[model samples]
Target: MINSSPGTSQTRSITQTSISQTRSFTTVSLIEMWERFGYYGMAALLVLFMIDKIGFADDHANLTWGAFTALVFSAPSIGGWIGDKVLGARRTMIAGAIVLACGYLMLALPVDTLGFMYASLGVIVVGNGLFKSNAANLVRRIFEGDDARIDSAFTIYYMAVNIGSTFSMLATPWIKDHWGWHAAFAVCCGGMLLGLLNFALLRRSLAHVGSAPDDEPLRGSRVFAVIAGSLALAASTVFILQHKQVAVACVYAAGVAILAIFGFMLKTCDRSERAGLIAALILTLQVILFFVFYQQMSTSLTLFALRNVDPAFSIGGIALFTWSAAQFQALNPIWIMVLSPLLAFVYARQARRGRDMPVAAKYALGFVVVAIGFFVFGLSGRYAVEGRVSSWFMVAGYGLYSFGELLVSGLGLAMIARYVPARMGGFMMGAFFVATGVSQYLGSVVANFARMPAGNLDAAQSLPLYTHLFFGLGWLAAGGAVVAIALLPLLGKLSRAHQQATQAASRRESLAPAPISLNAKNV
Candidate 1:
């Protein structure tokens, strides 16, 4: 039997509480960074690896790249539900990491040709879908009700994501060049193992906290049903891969099914929650636009870096900063790390001083910034065509887009917790990820144009496509920002109501009786 010493027990309790308090922000960030590092490192090299190392054509590699990332983001919705209803976040996270680790190791195996590649990628996709969203929800669990710090926490967590991604990018190319493609994938496996270890060490600290499981037995059964459904869906995907025309029908049907479910869910919520949920739904639409552009990382943008920019030239006799295409992804995170803290401080100071801007307004500003970034991207394309494009253009675009991320996507996690009820908070977070996944799918669709064979399109035909892509993004960002500006007066009203709700919670907490005297004499 396990026996606890009084001193040890007391120390453990204190450690546990401290860990719980910080669970939302710190643990998530660390783990997320590691995961992103592995995932992005793989992503940064994926298309190129398929085309150059594996001998697939650019178009074929692009197709696989888009589909894989889309699936990775999508799997979490199912994973989150499992965590919330039965397995709990900690277990689900553990399972996901294990699956991901196994998937990476599978990739590292020296296998035959196209069939092995497809099978290995399928495993990774399923594993990633389970891993990505739930990990994010795990971070969201740490906040108290309506704490404005929620968004800032996500921004910080996102910073870790970038940092991990940066290191992976920097490392993968070097490792691959020195060893081989298999070694590069092995790096991803190494990260998954490290992340798994960190999480295992921290699990006890998160006990009794984080996306608690449903107490009802029926809830468990329902979750199993969903898992079964997901498996069936996966099987269907396999079938569609074999049969082309059915894929078209499945996409349309999925869209309709999703819209119908959303309508029903909105109608089911309480009035205040429904109002907030509707706003969130609008934000989701906006997020789709953001992800459409962002997803270019694994698509058109990867190809651009590969085909165009010359690797850094060595100075004197030494190799100076010559890097892989994957390293470019590092810039986004670097920007996030620099900007998140400053934005958090500014917003917190404004709140303390009673001069804070509305959430919608901040988000609106973010969208506008995003448009500018895309415009910069378009400009870079033209400049490249003119035979003199600076690497600084790509750098500038990432900076602008990073700022835009701070404003819109970074703020979203906090907004979800603030607006959602306690019981449904995790589910709503799952929904947010679902929205992100869907948008990525849409981005993949858009990316099809960008990856089209140069021989297929005349120069004039390509010009319209590029123009529409960049300027369309610009117009959408600006229009969305304008709409958010108009909604600020209303967002202010919601913010006040949310503040009052918080104050009421605080008042209740303050009204509770003081703890009994610990050292009282016996009667």
Candidate 2:
């Protein structure tokens, strides 16, 4: 056999590495897709389910969802740390998936009691806390050191979320209509099971990647401890969800705690790390604002669809198809899927040319479009027929909102990857989710501004309440855009400092002498 030249061998090696990377990323994406399928499937119907079945009033339902979601998002902070320190990211993710599947199965049980529902939600909260950040950290690890690839990869990864959500959001509502609520929840359980199976089949694709713990054999004692702690946490979550006052207190406390964590990190980190942490903190605040807008899709917007927006897709006088109100939530993910590739292409191209827009600037631009989207929602009222706006308006508004999301929330994780150090990646990712969780609770509070008054209000009576809220949200987004723009110069300075410090550190590493080997062969 003829020996290959170095050049040919190098090229072949690179090709194989690329293929492995692709396979690993694809496995993670598909798993995340299915997780989203189950989560969004349940989310699409949860508020409505509470209102109709549990007899929760409008405000109560909105706040309860908000509180539950806040806890759901916040749980990731501890989970991410666990992934980094206690369990391997890969193992933690697998465990979380299993827990989530069990949670959905609980919802599938034929119980409509308040206690049962709250317990089911608590289980989901625990699972999400464990699953969300570790899964994201895995993707970050897969493309470590390549900032350009990180952004593009996360954007595509985000598209996976929408892909799962779009199908579930549409299907679950239809399933609820055709079969019943519990049957629909069972479908969500089935999706998670499918995800777990898919992950198992391709698990070896990730064999070469994970946290420090992955290299160590798992201890039975550690596993037992984690399980016991998780059960306690799950029970606490049930109590938290049941008590709105406690949730409010927890949200505020968490908000303050995150700020303190950032301040402490900034104070303690090396010069090389300080600027990056500052940049991340600023960007994290922007993400919080963006998610507030996001929260409306499930709370205020879905309720608006239920009351004021016509649910039929039509052209002239021809009706195409009619969707239930909850199904309209699918529009956000649908538009996300449509926009993700286009944005990813643009990001990759810009990165190649070294002309990519700064993340802060993107946030400003995101808020501008988010404002426009809300304005579209507000304006839809102008042409309403007997207080019912055409479904096309929702489509148009969601498209714009989704575009803004691409700019802001879609890049949020990429921002963490770009700025935060690899060692801090898992925990900071959790912190970012904590910020989003706080905003989710705040968003629900915001949704209450248009909470329907008790009694059966006609569509005409309800129309103005939503329109007024939409217009106010538009202005809030506009203000956010202004603030983001105002911070760009500061962000630019910080970004430069971070880059320079990073390069200087890299030079130190490269120029340093190699360690002397003490082995017998070397001696």
Candidate 3:
């Protein structure tokens, strides 16, 4: 009674394949959501906690945060190698979740000493290094060879980040107000634990995927080695965070090292891989510029909200509930959650129509919007009443900023997945993150340009400082846009070469003769 036609069988196979991929993607996305929840919950309060409780001056706080985050981002380079070669991506990711939970728990303790804080941050940097790149690599693996779906999938995956961050960014600040900061940090720890549990329950979905090591039995010696190495990295992180000059030197060194690494890869890789790497490098530089603007959400923008922006939403003489200054950080994720789906839809549609835009072109448009968003922020000063802009202005500016983020930062990982060969995917992904980390530190340094003079400065005195910085940033972004546009012709040519090489390689593989069995000859 069952039909056995090739068409019917092929349709069923496709359906099953789709279901399996969806389940795997969902499992990874959910864990990522929880991880981000823990991370953002802590992030929303970190700088303010340093300033208000630790008594750091604005410059010291900004630079310190920059250094800490730089280390956090840079650690992934080593982690990606570990995931690809030593332990399986799945196992490494789980270990990272455990380490991150412990780090958050440390912060929840009542110890407010600088040493304790630095140690806590060090642990987090190690854990993030292990977790971030591997999680992204898994997503890339799940959709390998499917270029169109990769873009849409990553955009939705990005939504997972916003979903987690939005809740924690809003909730952590409120918890700090009521239960105290330690309690808020405890909630972050709880979020990580929850993510680990969620992953445990659904991990079978990824049983067939991951690096070569995933297929092998567990090795205790490997686990021990990884743990020992992680400890050393964590200690070094503590030292780095404590020394501003050392951190700066390390960041610059990393920047140079990444460029050299790219050059080496281009020189050594086959002709097929060269074009893609070149495209990746050019796009990566654009990402560095974008993150400088992105870092404002946590640093200067948060400080702006604290000093120069009205906290309450209002309309036509009607009053709404007010938010804590820290909670304004939630706006970026809120807009991201709203916009990710729309952008993903457009990408999917364009891909299906065979009219997909180049990622390079997307980067150009992203900077255009980013420039506009900063301009909005800069111009908001013109409308300030008593040196405070309406909350609506923040909403509008964040909307435009978040859109640019989708086009550039959201697609950053996808760029790696598309261009890098599968053999080097993990390491290259790590390198991309390293680039972003370097930029994160740079962004913090840029934030210092708006650093206020000591003393109780009111909103009126601080407003101009932030607006001037915003104007300068807007102009910088406009320049970035112009440069991106100028490079489009080159990027387009490289993209075509990469695509032709890929197709040629695929054809060669498909046309190769099947191996002859010795048994057939014996018969």
Quantify all predictions' global Cα lDDT against the true fold.
Answer: 0.68, 0.94, 0.93
What shift in Å separates residue 400 of candidate 1 from its native position after superposition? 0.6
What is the alpha-carbon RMSD of candidate 1 to the true structure?
A: 6.2
**Stretch of 10 with least lDDT, candidate 2:** 143-152
Q: Identify the runs in model 2 with alpha carbons over 4 angstroms from their true place.
A: 1-7
**Per-residue CA lDDT of candidate 3, range 180-218, in tens?**
999999999999999999998999999987999988898
Candidate 3 residue runs with Cα over 4 Å from true position: 1-3, 517-523
Candidate 2 lDDT over residue span 49-127, tens digit each: 9999999999999999999899899999989988999988999999999999999999999999999999999899889
What TM-score, computed on C-alpha atoms, does each candidate reach?
Answer: 0.82, 0.98, 0.98
What's every prediction's RMSD, in angstroms? 6.2, 1.2, 1.2
Residue 461 CA displacement from its true place in model 3, Å: 0.4
Model 2 steric clash pairs: none
